[model samples]
Target: MSDPVDFRDNRGVGTLISDLIQQVSSLMQTEIRLLRAEMGDKLKTMLGGAVEVLAGGLLLMAALLILLQALVVALAHWVGAGWASLIVGLVVAVIGVILVKRGTSNIEPSNLTPDQTTNQLARDAAVVKEQFK
Candidate 1:
């Protein structure tokens, strides 16, 4: 029976180092891809929040104009025209503030961060550190 030759005996330190470098390079590329994907998802979420804020602002503006006029006309009998208009304006402004606040909450720093990628990279670094030790 023929015996198989062992390849490990022929492998030098330089070859091992080269293989290590290649592995690290591949790992970095994969991490970068993951980072990009995570960032893209966060960006999409941010974009959705921004769109919601914009839509809310537009709706608020429309409501301010139309509802203000309607409310002012409706309540003008109970209060004077000017007081009714002022009250309506204040109410619409408050609602607009609430909508804006809700939309902006979704775009906070925490929500916009690539949390998964950050955690993954930290874990990877810890693993590499442990391996080196």
Candidate 2:
């Protein structure tokens, strides 16, 4: 990545303008590359979170199945066993829901936005404009 142009020489006006354009173009390209890299990193993180959500969903489904099957069978035999099974299933379901929520937040639009890269570009633009003044 190239630094912003520092035009302090007694160069021709046209040459200076051309150099400035080139430097600005280089800066833009560099920022774009950085943005792409940042986006890629976010996507990978989101994907990992998505996997967690999927696993959580599976756990949720299993917990529900456990609750249904256990309650139906255990209730016929003993009230105490049925209550214990229900408690265990509810605990598992709660854990699954928490996992899903955490994973969902990881993929949220707020989390995915390339705020750092955007801010960096803005700072670079301000510096270049300052030099212009």
Q: lDDT of each structure?
A: 0.79, 0.90
TM-score of 1: 0.71
Q: lDDT tens digits, residues 1-64, model 2?
A: 9798766788999998999999999999999999999999999989988988998999899899
lDDT of residue 105 for candidate 1: 83
Q: Provide backbone clash counts, one per model.
A: 0, 0
Please report, as a residue range, the 10-residue window in candidate 1 with the lowest summed lDDT.
78-87
* Model 2 regions lying over 4 Å from their true place: 1-8, 79-84
Q: Over the stretch 1-133, how does candidate 1's per-residue lDDT look in tens digits? A: 8698566667788997788788788989998999899889988878877877887797689667866686767676665775666667767777777777778987888997888888888998997787575
Clashing pairs in 1: none
TM-score of 2: 0.83
lDDT (Cα) of model 1: 0.79
Q: What local lDDT does model 1 show for residue 28? A: 90
- Angstrom error of the Cα, residue 101, model 1: value is 4.0
